[model samples]
Target: MIDALYVAETGLQAGQKHIDTISNNMANLNTTAYKKGRIEFRDLVVGREVTSLDETGKRDLVSIGNGTQISRVWKEFQSGDLKATENPLDLAIRGGGFFEVLLENGEVAYTRNGAMKVDEDGYLGTLTGYRFSDMIQIPPDAKELEISQDGTVTAYFDNDSLEIGQIQLAGFMNAQGLDSIGQGIYVANDESGNAIYSDAGENGIGILQQGYLESSNVDLVKELVELVTAQRGYQACSHVIRAADEIMQITNDLRG
Candidate 1:
């Protein structure tokens, strides 16, 4: 009876985790270049045959099955839809790539978000203030900025255009392994492999589309269906717990 209760508890926990993941995805539906998260589960088994030696030498065997557990939570890196924003500073990639951003701690992070803006210091950066990893700077007096599909940055000033610098994209062997820090940013870890820098349209990187941004890849309909399933699963687990408790109570009452 107690084992049944434990199994049900595990089921309840797993259901809750699934619901939480879906909830987060729904919350970020409108976030630029946002990727959805998924949860994986593993089964747990308890009770197995074990040999024990008594003072007089003895052998014993036992077998037990526990329940399920959450094995991993990973993000799906499927490319999101690119929408035209008509903003010169907005950018989007149509393939597998991420923009490299330099963090305040001198470390670097990666993101698919391309909503960039130039600051008073002539440094181009993301809305969150993280500058591009490369030294792509703009002139203080530049009237227009253009980023080519190949990542060439051009500045127009006084009826003249000049190439400033080039923006680069980073790729990973296992992007799903990257650690997500909020705000649609991720940091590479050993599991994700080191960052591979390349031109936007070179080395398997994606082509850049100026005046556009990537929309979150979350599918609202699918998430809503999954949310409902998770809720039902949670309720079923609770029912199991109730049944187990009733059995335990009946067993206790028999001793009266």
Candidate 2:
């Protein structure tokens, strides 16, 4: 009976964690370039015993399972839908890649959010003011700007056009291993490997789409279904705990 209580407790914890993950995913449904999170669980075994010997002298074993535990939580890196915008600075990736931005602390962070803006100094950066790693600057007198699918940046002044710079993309071996720092930004770690920098559309990198932004990859219907399942699981665990308590109470009454 005590073991039943411990097992149900583990189940309750697992269900709560699952619900939390679903909630987070739903909350970021409208965030730009947001990736949904996934949770994994593993079964816990408390004990193992040899029950009997078979005809071939092999021992028959019985394993006692404790409960389930959270194994890992990872981000799904699948591409989100691209949304068209009138702003030329807005960009979207058609495949696998991430935009590199220099943070305030001088550390380079990777993101899929491509809603960019020009600063007062004519320097192009993200909407959050994180400058591009390469620091592409536009001339003050530039009348128009254009970005090609291959990430070539050009500025038009009257009838003449000048190539200013090129936008580069960074990729990782295991993007799911990247650590998210909120606001659609991620940082690379040992598990994610190093960032592989390259031109857009080159070396398996994704092509750039000017005037478009990537929408959040969260599926509302899926999250709602998961929420329902997690709630039911939590309720089932609660019932198990209550039953265990009642069994203990009955045993005490009999003894009395």
RMSD of every prediction: 2.7, 2.3
Task: List where candidate 2 sits over 4 angstroms from the true fold.
Answer: 48-62
Q: Supply the TM-score for candidate 2.
A: 0.92
lDDT of 2 by residue, 156-177 (tens): 9988999999999999999999
lDDT of 1 by residue, 96-200 (tens): 999999999999999999999886687989999999988688988889999999899999998799999999999999999999998989999999999998898
Per-prediction TM-score: 0.94, 0.92
Whose lDDT is greatest here?
Answer: 2
Residue 232 shift from truth in candidate 1, angstroms:
1.5
